[model samples]
Target: MADTARRTDDLLAGLPVPGARSPGQGERAAGAKNTARAARSRFMAAHGEEVYDRLTDGRTRHLRLRELVDAAAREFPGLVPDAAQLAQESARPQADKDGREIDQGIFFSRLLGSPLAGPHLMDAMLRPTDRALRLLPDFRRTGFADLGSVTLERRGSAAHLTMCRPDCLNAEDNEQVEAMETAVDLALLDPAVHVGLLRGGEMTHPRYRGRRVFSAGINLKSLHAGRISLVDFLLRRELGYIAKLMRGVLVDHETSWQSRTIEKPWVAAVDTFAIGGGMQLLMVFDRVIAGSDAYLSLPAAQEGIVPGAGNFRLGRLAGGRISRQVVLWGRRLWASEPDARLLIDEVVDPAAVGAAADAALERLDSPAVVTNRRVLNLAEEPPEAFRAYLAEFSLQQALRLYSEDVIGKVGRFSAGCAAPPA
Candidate 1:
């Protein structure tokens, strides 16, 4: 673990900072606007000219993103692609002989794989989209890349933040998280947006088709390949995005202070499952509208990594004993389970999830949700508990990142998401 902690320092030192905006760069965003290819070209010029040549060179048609990443990995060991806005903006989608278009997903895969992209990805995900920042809420999706995956469209006083990647069971990679964080903040900042309905899109998989899976957790393929770094995982997740959720406080030896004042009511519509980090996120919601068939768990113990903020949040929501069974014993809690039921405000049929969530939102006075949540935090949230837990979770998880324990379980764990129950 000591050695692992040391490696984290050396590894992250090379990663790019996520949300920094260079004054001079906006001047460059103009030339790249013509096409994705041009955006990608200029981006590469600013970041890696050699990479640009190899990608654009006639040797490789660069059809699928996976192929590009595989080729880049083979050619440049530990090479990090420049997916900066400069690159992303200038990039134009390319199709192979098959006519399948290539998007930023390739450079994104490599960037996520590098671990350098984590901080930037995390920070970028939390900020409002540039267009969203500059323009009105009505025009948020104007030119955003991530909105295609998890869209945030305004719906009557509430912003509907839906997870749209059914193929991956709504699993979050840097891309999804970035999209989610941006969407979340958009709702938080918008004056008209009083409530948020967090939900998932229809699944197309045979076993789960037409069903909405809340989220399968972090993208496991990226995890299996070790593209996501530990600090990046802990910071963006446990301590960063998830932590900034409410007005909870972070007390220390010196002083106690509120985490972040900017907050709004978030009501998660759990149509199916909220496993792993998906379940971890539930603690921050004002209310959870789970489907009757919904299942929940924090399988970090099984996955060989300490669960993120789930440890603290779950313990707070469901009690310490139940959370321990989960964080330690890999206990799977169904919606009907006593421990699970305690946290779930309401459980309705799958078909009624939409109505139930909106109904719940309608039942509450939006401003009151925020006020009452603060009241609940005062009563339930222990001083320095979350901060202390994440401190430990991040350090130990960093160790788990390089541990044989995780490497062995990742294949089984990741594949299990799409598999039918035995």
Candidate 2:
């Protein structure tokens, strides 16, 4: 565990700082008129002419731009190809004999934004063009690169769960959701993962919701146009996968379930939005740290959808009435809401959200095992069995929670509509 903690710390140090970039780089790329020119200039400025020539020389030898950037992007996340390479890749036909040269445009487009021509530009580059080109990167088609979804970094007795999806606003499409379920299943199966923290990046996009994004729920971008058609198929697949992962976690509990190893209490602090599937993940944690902006909402209703399988889990944790109110209406509920007060233990200003979460985590009693057992027992069964449930069932409680939703909905609406539309 000591070694694991050290390694985890080192990994954090090595990972590229998110949103950290040279000034003018992002503004240029996102600019309506100068995006392409900016991307090209930025590429040259960052990679000296010497390196550019070396790359082009290598490319002439049939090296694909995707292959080169994917190698470099491991260290530099936002880097792009040179203009010369981009033009050549785009000019090469789909049936070109040289696979690497022709595919460069596809790779560059996916990493950066696809041209205004279409989002599938990047997908076409990296995948087989025959069947894959016809189907955009969605539920029906997946990336050829077998990118794993969840990353686990063992720290002392608890393993920190890193929910990584660098693209698509951290959205949980069918593939990402499957990855998260697998990570949790691993934690549950391995008694060593006594605690877990589910989290998301602050700036996630292409499927962004305003300026904020949360891991609490699924991002709408991941769902395909025909997502409704495949609900049953997706549901069955997820259930089977999640069940197996959970079974693995619970299997060895009878013995070797030592709990005193971790010196810290289990906690998951949600930074920004924790909506949709992200909120479902929060339920799996024992203690939650929420930010002022960290209101919970189920926007699926706005799109004429329900949370589906995750609904039961949420209802089990929050009182059934409160859960239904949130999901059915798809309204945002804040800390002041009567039901929200009962649902979330603490709410702090955005400035204090992180520190507050750290404080809450530091105060929990340990042996760690006892705390976890209590939480699972409290949350696992239907809320009806707990004394907490009775308090939640009161008509007075329902009115207050619902009232908060109304006040928040009317008073706290966005000042203006989103630019691209959600």
Candidate 3:
């Protein structure tokens, strides 16, 4: 009987039980392992002592015992854990969520203590919606080593270029000019970009730092010294090249159209004297926002040279009488000139110039319309001559001659006609 009992015990130990299986038995062992893992998982999830100990510290994301209980109730159906139990388990103290703290300060006392509390409390406890703040000109990461001390930022769809080069009003060296031009061209080429804001290349005013001034002109010292200069030949070449490039963009069969895949309107706020080449670029823009502290001049005549590209274009835009005075005499026109036709559009206060540009931009809805109209009107008179020139000189021939000859002739003839008969 004892031998039989011993044999029966041996059989029970060797054979698989209801919940247990031998590890050496592959398929059965895997099933057993899975069951063991599931049981361990349930136990761990219920206690989670190891997880809590590993993850939490004194500074860990701690919630109030009551809040935890409430949250648990929300997550688990009909299972609201005890707040006191949670408080005992989790030693971390809880005051309130940051948002709730704001609400408490705003409306907690009033609600708890007043008759007017209930109705107003809900409203007061509400927080204002938060919005993402972004850097303007979106140029936060942009850095230019050769740009001297100028820093540019984005303002809406425009790139705002500011010269932070001390109060010396040092004229633009080649490095500075190249940097500015490259940066401007980069921003201009971008389809998303619209306008550029230029500021502080000059002092506001030497006597009054707040008053504002502009850089005198291209650094003549650098120019004459030949260290880095704006020589006439180089200037003419560069100017013609840039103007031609701009005309291509502005008059392209595709880009010229406002609805094209790529197109933009440009404007600049001249804070001070945009003299020489700097002033020349301003004419290329659709508009100029002249600061009250600003002055516009053409100083090539003063330098015993012609403004060339600048003078020719200015003459077209401003008419001969005014253009001659501006270029030949180098007259400094203030931003508030009531009769200044050359400036284009309105003369506004410096502070209001930005707003004015925006208002003007709103009015010019279609760049295509503007370009086409100007092209047609410029091509209207001297059609045969323009066509002949167009065959040789192309569109530029018309733009230049129309101003020099057409306007000049028309003005002379009109004056002759209006004069008293001899």
Q: Return the top candidate by lDDT.
A: 1
Tens-digit per-residue lDDT, 23-75, candidate 3 = 45435433443343344334334533332222223214233212322443344
lDDT of 2 by residue, 1-422 (tens): 22332333244334322134234643432242133334433553454333333544633422222344544434333333334433443353222111121122222322223122111211122222122123223311221212265565554445455555645445565566545544454444444444555555544443553433455444333222212112212332223233222222222234436531112234666666666656655554457777776676666555343353446566766778877777777767775565665556777776776567555544553555455554564457432332222222221221221232422432222222221222
Candidate 3 lDDT score relative to the true structure: 0.41
- Sliding window of 10 residues with minimal summed lDDT for model 3: 95-104
Local lDDT at 350 for model 1: 75
Off by over 4 Å in 1: 1-146, 248-260, 414-417, 420-422
Q: What is the TM-score of each candidate against the true structure?
A: 0.64, 0.46, 0.46
Cα lDDT, all candidates = 0.57, 0.41, 0.41
How displaced is residue 419 in candidate 1, in Å?
Answer: 3.5
Model 3, 104: alpha-carbon shift in Å?
Answer: 77
